[model samples]
Target: MSASLEKGIHALKEQVDSTVAAFFSSCVHCGMCADACLFYTETGEPERMPINKVEPLRRIWKSEYTLLGRIGKLFGLTKKVDDKLLTEWETLVYDSCTLCGRCSMVCPVGNDIALMIRKTREGMAVAGHAPEGLIGATTRAITIGSPMGVKLPALQAQIRHVEESTGKTIPVDVEGAEYMLLLSSMEIMNFPEFIEAVSKIFDRAGVSWTISTEAFEATNSGIQIGVSDLAAELVQRIVDAAEKLKVKTVISPECGHAYMAIRWEGPNLVGKPFSFKVRHILEVLNELREQGKLEISSRETQKLTYHDPCQISRRGGVINEPRSLLDMVADNFVEMPDTGKMNWCCGAGGGVSSNERADEIRLKVFQRKKEQLDAIKPDAIVSACSNCRLNLEDALEEYNMDIPLLSLTEMLADHLAD
Candidate 1:
């Protein structure tokens, strides 16, 4: 019932569905996934390979789930997974890998390596192998309604400040609002300007948007920590709040993993399709632009480049929305070397930013991003995800780079027509 090695192995056995079986069976051992992974590419460690990271889970599946595995186990040919093996693998799973899905993108056999890693973390957590920081964050998310312990009063204070500064009212829990906005804790505590920017933009566009005091937090630490039960609980709050408010759509904030968790994973985690649709904020802004509701008075003449947050552009299928918005406002916008789906991760995704233990390795692997930035050498970097912005800013400071970070929504709001 409680977390233990037996429970972790049992959980691993349960995760071995047909897709996982096929993935493990179809691996060609070609090492293509290695080159695609930033961890492996950075350290050249064979153990950091995405496929290798899930080997413990794979061994369980081989021995317990498959007929051939069962036969092999009969002869004691299968390698047993133990605490020692898991202890050795904790660094590979938590510290090195960011679950960026680049390996999945380049898998020659179409294996969803990233998803497998997420599933593998379920077992890891059960075995008590998850990073201490992620465990604390998940605990806070369940107990305090936010990973960062941001409560409604904090949100209300921010809301009051934005209302006072902008001279606009921010609707909360308004029944039948056209769109419901969900924000990440990072947006609330670190980037309160994001709330103000969205408020001004929606007010100028004459849009009906309300914030939900009940389910305002968007980032799901449960998903990051790879626990479905906790993830579903988080998703249920959003579903309950959205259905109760009768909002037509819920707009995921400019945070990358938040968009992926709320927009893509929330429905499945909650075990049913949501009553309302979920959309990334960029998608809604683009819709408003197409509808001629969002108008810009002037363009920015700065030489800037867009940093595609892995979840926002690659995982969320929002590649063009931010680019279109940027093209409208930025006169000299340039693309990074791999600007779209193949763009490099900010190196702090998949809960790495929350885990203080990953600080050094995260900055070390950030060399790939550093190389990309050095090549373009833009005036500033613009991105949607607040998490990515924080990571990028940290890494920039680590490297002593002078480039600044900008948010797409904030930029669009700045150029709004009077």
Candidate 2:
């Protein structure tokens, strides 16, 4: 190896050492985390087990850092790290697993495997082994505020279009607004009607809400890219905007990953706790329902099944609010077998929807979810995450399945009192 290559490898080893130390220190291998893992249950392979899922990293820790490891290395008993090992680790870290934290929920030790995976990703990123889609999204987020690269000018134009369509003057950074409405770029590009829906809902509810074209996007590709610094920077934009606007609440729009970044990890990413509250759109609508501000007319008589976005429902602990809204809007709501927090992923989480190389793998991963939906025979599938919608749409198109996808905001807007 060249001197530069050696230096790079040494630096990566240091990172791996630190990350593995943190991971092993956090997990006790109690086996509870396995119960929540779908891959383990589906394949019945111990190697694919959740606790066992971290073994590749754990082996590196044991062979490099632990006292026993040094002795084993001295005796040539421990495996040496090499390019082949790195390749295998790469597949396990990126392809064989999704960063869904169902395992974290069942862990008695509160060991966040997602964090470990992210740390692993950091090391892989240093080695230039990250997925193309993740790298692209991160680069875009760093260059522009959002992963989709929707700049200030485009965002303002989209906002204008939404205002024109709704005929409602959506406030932008109005001084002392009660809420700062954060939107994801996906809605702006593919589902602009969601923007209109939110504006109409807020207008009808008489709630003071403003959108910040300056900090327009809530989508954090940093988390998707596994870069903590980039994630922190993207999160700071929202924090600064909220402080500047003096909004009491930061209402995230209908996107799962955005909600997770803002609601669950925003406080941590910002370094200190935020004084303002963060709520998902469904939560806001539920609050409006409780206040008697949101009135629903007769339900639309159509078959519908809801797909739970992993980030929002599983990670952010928001499951019932959207379903309650769906129940109020639809006459017939069919429950999928694995509904709520336990539901299967739409195979679009963790930035896989944008990955060209992983597209086939993603489609194959959704076979189980498609089976569930086909069993219900629903006319429409209601979901909150933009990525989920994109993946499901692609799957429907690929399999020639005939189910229309709708966002919760769009569905509720249909039943909103005009």
Candidate 3:
């Protein structure tokens, strides 16, 4: 075996704990997950099935862990995972699957297929089978401390712009602040208005929050590329920065995977509980609204619908918070066919947006989102995740749909009550 393939098989072997064993054993091959997957639904290809995409992982479990398969291995009757298999499945694993957790939500036999895909990616990454886009992102995440290669100076410049526009001093490295806010590089580079929006909302609500110069990047490419060590290193940056600043909470901005990385998976990846708490910005904003601190001067009149980022809604358990926050600022809010936790992915999450090779397939599978929007026919769409917003914008332009895309935070900021 080639060294990379050997390392990948060993990595796959290491991932087969009791949970994985149960998940593999419990799968009934009922095709429920296939139907749940948007790639399969849009493309009508069996290879895109969520369960089939992780076939390599399942093979490893059977050949090494099961009694009958152990006998087959002894007789050289088992199918071995090789570099060829990894290369072939790289597209299926990395390019097609979005890790959106929708398949996990709809598994009839309760198989968490999306989780298994992630486990499969751990082996794929070790085998050097990850996509060029994701590999580049993971590398930049470790080396440059931002997947998009954003630097602290860029963030400082953006903060200065926001500060000057809002006439509110943007706090940085402020010790003992109630919250340390983190931003995705997309927001830093592509959507600086999100930073401005947060400033306006926090100023109006009198919330104690500061940006950390040491660790402000919210998104974790490590998690996307399935490198736990790299992911742990990235998470530790935020944990250390938060503890050093003695902040009460680390607020994950409008980035879905970032919230999942830092808030849901960070503690486990680091093998320890956090010294402080972590919450999504929506959760924090909803709390402030409930406390009567967040108010809107006027409600949005145009018809608006929410696009629930899969990580934030399904994976992160932040379903109702966005809707409740919208209630404060949108009088004509509408729901898509499958809103909230069950909403469809934007076809660009889970590092798919970063993978240029997957761009065509990404836009192709965007038909699912197009159908969702056609059902509601809203004047605009509101979403809490920047990654989703960018993807939605691109897809909307491709489909020649003129509907506007709005950030929920920016909307609230625009209507902040006096």
Model 2 regions more than 4 Å off: 1-56, 64-67, 73-77, 80-83, 103-112
The order by descending lDDT is 3, 1, 2
lDDT of 3 by residue, 176-241 (tens): 999999999999999999999898889888989999999999999999999889999999999999
- Model 1: per-residue lDDT, tens digit, 38-127? 888877788889999998889998898889889999999999998988888887887877888888999999998988998889888888
Candidate 1 CA-lDDT value:
0.90
Q: What TM-score against the true fold does each predicted structure earn?
A: 0.98, 0.87, 0.99
Which pairs clash inside model 3? none
2 or 3: which has the higher lDDT?
3
Cα RMSD (angstroms) for every candidate in the order listed: 1.3, 3.5, 0.8
As for lDDT, the candidate ahead, 1 or 3, is 3
Q: Relative to the unseen true structure, what is the C-alpha lDDT of residue 314 in candidate 1, on a scale of 0 to 100?
A: 78
So what's the TM-score on candidate 2?
Answer: 0.87
lDDT (10s digit) by residue, model 2, range 283-313: 9988898798988765768898888888888
Worst 10 residues of 2 by lDDT: 2-11
Q: What is the Å distance of residue 254 in model 3 from its true position?
A: 0.5
